[model samples]
Target: MEEWVIGPRLYNCYKCGNMICRHDDIVSKTFQEDRRLITGLHTVADVYCCDCGERLGWRYIKAYEEMYKYKEGKIVLEKFKLANENNW
Candidate 1:
Protein backbone atom coordinates (compact mmCIF):
# COMPACT_ATOMS: atom_id res chain seq x y z
CA MET A 1 0.00 0.00 0.00
CA GLU A 2 1.05 3.59 -0.49
CA GLU A 3 2.64 5.34 2.48
CA TRP A 4 -0.14 7.04 4.46
CA VAL A 5 0.66 10.73 4.69
CA ILE A 6 0.26 12.58 8.00
CA GLY A 7 1.65 15.23 10.35
CA PRO A 8 2.44 18.81 9.24
CA ARG A 9 1.47 18.28 5.64
CA LEU A 10 -2.12 17.13 5.81
CA TYR A 11 -5.69 18.28 5.15
CA ASN A 12 -8.53 19.34 7.47
CA CYS A 13 -12.06 20.13 6.41
CA TYR A 14 -12.21 23.78 7.32
CA LYS A 15 -15.94 23.95 6.73
CA CYS A 16 -16.68 21.61 9.65
CA GLY A 17 -13.36 20.72 11.40
CA ASN A 18 -14.00 17.09 10.69
CA MET A 19 -11.11 14.74 11.32
CA ILE A 20 -10.73 11.52 9.37
CA CYS A 21 -10.88 9.45 12.58
CA ARG A 22 -14.52 10.29 13.17
CA HIS A 23 -16.82 7.29 13.32
CA ASP A 24 -19.40 8.64 10.85
CA ASP A 25 -17.94 9.81 7.54
CA ILE A 26 -18.31 9.15 3.84
CA VAL A 27 -17.23 10.23 0.37
CA SER A 28 -20.14 11.93 -1.31
CA LYS A 29 -18.83 12.46 -4.84
CA THR A 30 -16.10 11.89 -7.39
CA PHE A 31 -13.97 14.73 -8.69
CA GLN A 32 -11.19 15.19 -11.24
CA GLU A 33 -7.46 15.53 -10.72
CA ASP A 34 -4.17 15.77 -12.59
CA ARG A 35 -3.95 12.17 -13.70
CA ARG A 36 -0.94 12.48 -15.98
CA LEU A 37 1.23 9.93 -14.24
CA ILE A 38 -1.70 7.81 -13.09
CA THR A 39 -2.84 4.71 -14.93
CA GLY A 40 -6.60 5.29 -14.38
CA LEU A 41 -6.76 2.53 -11.77
CA HIS A 42 -8.38 4.74 -9.17
CA THR A 43 -11.59 6.69 -8.69
CA VAL A 44 -11.51 10.04 -6.98
CA ALA A 45 -14.05 10.24 -4.13
CA ASP A 46 -15.28 13.43 -2.56
CA VAL A 47 -15.07 12.92 1.20
CA TYR A 48 -17.15 14.81 3.69
CA CYS A 49 -17.73 15.24 7.40
CA CYS A 50 -20.87 13.38 8.36
CA ASP A 51 -21.71 15.70 11.20
CA CYS A 52 -21.50 18.98 9.32
CA GLY A 53 -21.59 17.93 5.68
CA GLU A 54 -18.26 19.46 4.79
CA ARG A 55 -15.97 18.42 1.99
CA LEU A 56 -12.67 16.93 3.03
CA GLY A 57 -10.94 16.00 -0.22
CA TRP A 58 -10.80 13.59 -3.10
CA ARG A 59 -9.92 9.95 -2.38
CA TYR A 60 -8.09 7.60 -4.71
CA ILE A 61 -10.01 4.35 -4.51
CA LYS A 62 -8.80 1.20 -6.18
CA ALA A 63 -10.85 0.51 -9.30
CA TYR A 64 -11.31 -3.16 -8.50
CA GLU A 65 -12.68 -2.95 -4.97
CA GLU A 66 -14.44 0.42 -5.14
CA MET A 67 -14.41 0.72 -1.35
CA TYR A 68 -13.00 3.11 1.21
CA LYS A 69 -10.43 2.42 3.97
CA TYR A 70 -11.14 5.33 6.29
CA LYS A 71 -14.69 4.70 7.47
CA GLU A 72 -17.30 2.39 6.02
CA GLY A 73 -17.47 4.54 2.88
CA LYS A 74 -14.93 7.24 3.68
CA ILE A 75 -11.20 7.65 3.14
CA VAL A 76 -8.82 7.63 6.09
CA LEU A 77 -7.39 11.11 5.73
CA GLU A 78 -4.40 12.28 7.72
CA LYS A 79 -6.00 15.56 8.60
CA PHE A 80 -3.92 18.34 10.07
CA LYS A 81 -4.72 19.25 13.64
CA LEU A 82 -4.90 22.94 12.91
CA ALA A 83 -6.44 24.96 10.09
CA ASN A 84 -4.75 25.95 6.82
CA GLU A 85 -1.19 25.77 8.12
CA ASN A 86 0.74 23.98 5.37
CA ASN A 87 -2.25 23.38 3.13
CA TRP A 88 -1.22 24.90 -0.15
Candidate 2:
Protein backbone atom coordinates (compact mmCIF):
# COMPACT_ATOMS: atom_id res chain seq x y z
CA MET A 1 0.00 0.00 0.00
CA GLU A 2 1.23 3.47 -0.86
CA GLU A 3 0.71 6.53 1.31
CA TRP A 4 -0.46 9.65 -0.50
CA VAL A 5 -0.84 13.35 0.36
CA ILE A 6 -2.51 16.38 -1.22
CA GLY A 7 -1.37 19.95 -0.94
CA PRO A 8 -3.01 22.45 1.39
CA ARG A 9 -4.17 24.36 -1.63
CA LEU A 10 -7.31 23.16 -3.31
CA TYR A 11 -7.22 23.43 -7.07
CA ASN A 12 -9.94 25.21 -8.98
CA CYS A 13 -10.57 25.43 -12.70
CA TYR A 14 -8.94 28.57 -13.98
CA LYS A 15 -11.34 28.72 -16.91
CA CYS A 16 -14.35 28.07 -14.74
CA GLY A 17 -15.34 28.68 -11.14
CA ASN A 18 -15.78 25.01 -10.46
CA MET A 19 -14.03 23.54 -7.45
CA ILE A 20 -11.66 20.74 -8.37
CA CYS A 21 -12.16 17.43 -6.66
CA ARG A 22 -9.79 14.54 -6.25
CA HIS A 23 -10.24 10.99 -5.11
CA ASP A 24 -6.65 9.92 -4.73
CA ASP A 25 -3.15 11.32 -5.07
CA ILE A 26 -0.45 8.70 -4.94
CA VAL A 27 3.24 9.47 -4.94
CA SER A 28 5.57 6.82 -6.25
CA LYS A 29 8.69 8.87 -5.72
CA THR A 30 9.78 9.83 -2.26
CA PHE A 31 10.67 13.37 -1.18
CA GLN A 32 14.37 12.66 -1.65
CA GLU A 33 14.34 10.93 -5.04
CA ASP A 34 15.63 12.56 -8.19
CA ARG A 35 12.79 13.35 -10.60
CA ARG A 36 15.04 13.29 -13.67
CA LEU A 37 15.96 9.69 -13.06
CA ILE A 38 12.33 8.68 -13.28
CA THR A 39 11.29 8.37 -16.92
CA GLY A 40 7.84 9.71 -17.74
CA LEU A 41 6.61 10.19 -14.20
CA HIS A 42 2.88 9.54 -14.26
CA THR A 43 1.24 12.72 -12.95
CA VAL A 44 -2.43 13.09 -13.76
CA ALA A 45 -4.97 15.69 -12.57
CA ASP A 46 -8.22 14.16 -13.76
CA VAL A 47 -11.05 16.67 -13.69
CA TYR A 48 -14.21 17.80 -15.47
CA CYS A 49 -16.53 20.79 -15.62
CA CYS A 50 -20.19 20.23 -14.90
CA ASP A 51 -21.50 23.39 -16.52
CA CYS A 52 -19.46 23.10 -19.70
CA GLY A 53 -19.10 19.35 -19.64
CA GLU A 54 -15.50 19.77 -20.62
CA ARG A 55 -12.54 17.65 -19.63
CA LEU A 56 -10.19 19.71 -17.56
CA GLY A 57 -6.45 19.25 -17.26
CA TRP A 58 -5.39 15.73 -16.46
CA ARG A 59 -2.08 13.98 -15.87
CA TYR A 60 0.01 16.82 -14.51
CA ILE A 61 2.44 14.91 -12.33
CA LYS A 62 5.28 12.63 -13.31
CA ALA A 63 4.21 9.74 -11.09
CA TYR A 64 1.02 10.14 -9.10
CA GLU A 65 -2.57 8.91 -8.91
CA GLU A 66 -5.39 11.44 -8.65
CA MET A 67 -9.04 10.58 -8.80
CA TYR A 68 -11.85 13.09 -9.16
CA LYS A 69 -15.61 12.97 -8.73
CA TYR A 70 -17.70 15.58 -10.43
CA LYS A 71 -21.02 17.03 -9.30
CA GLU A 72 -22.65 15.62 -12.41
CA GLY A 73 -21.88 12.12 -11.21
CA LYS A 74 -18.62 11.33 -12.98
CA ILE A 75 -15.38 9.80 -11.85
CA VAL A 76 -11.91 10.42 -13.25
CA LEU A 77 -8.33 9.47 -12.47
CA GLU A 78 -5.46 11.97 -12.59
CA LYS A 79 -1.72 11.60 -12.00
CA PHE A 80 1.07 14.09 -11.24
CA LYS A 81 4.50 14.55 -9.69
CA LEU A 82 6.14 16.60 -6.97
CA ALA A 83 9.39 18.51 -7.11
CA ASN A 84 12.24 16.27 -6.08
CA GLU A 85 14.39 17.80 -3.36
CA ASN A 86 17.33 15.80 -4.61
CA ASN A 87 17.12 17.56 -7.96
CA TRP A 88 17.54 20.99 -6.37
Task: Highest lDDT: give the candidate number.
Answer: 1
- The residue ranges of model 1 lying beyond 4 angstroms of the native Cα positions read 1-12, 21-41, 63-88
For each candidate, the alpha-carbon lDDT, in order, equals 0.46, 0.38
**Model 2 alpha-carbon miss at residue 86, Å:** 28
* Model 1 C-alpha lDDT per residue in residues 11-43, reported as the tens digit of each score: 346666544442223243232335341444555
What would you estimate as the lDDT of candidate 2? Answer: 0.38
Worst 10 residues of 2 by lDDT: 65-74
- What is the lDDT, from 0 to 100, of the residue 55 in candidate 2? 66
* Backbone N/Cα/C clashes per model: 1, 19
Models 1 onward score TM values of 0.34, 0.27
Tens-digit lDDT string for candidate 2 (1-88): 9986644444444455455542233232133323242434354445566655556534333333233211122223222321222222
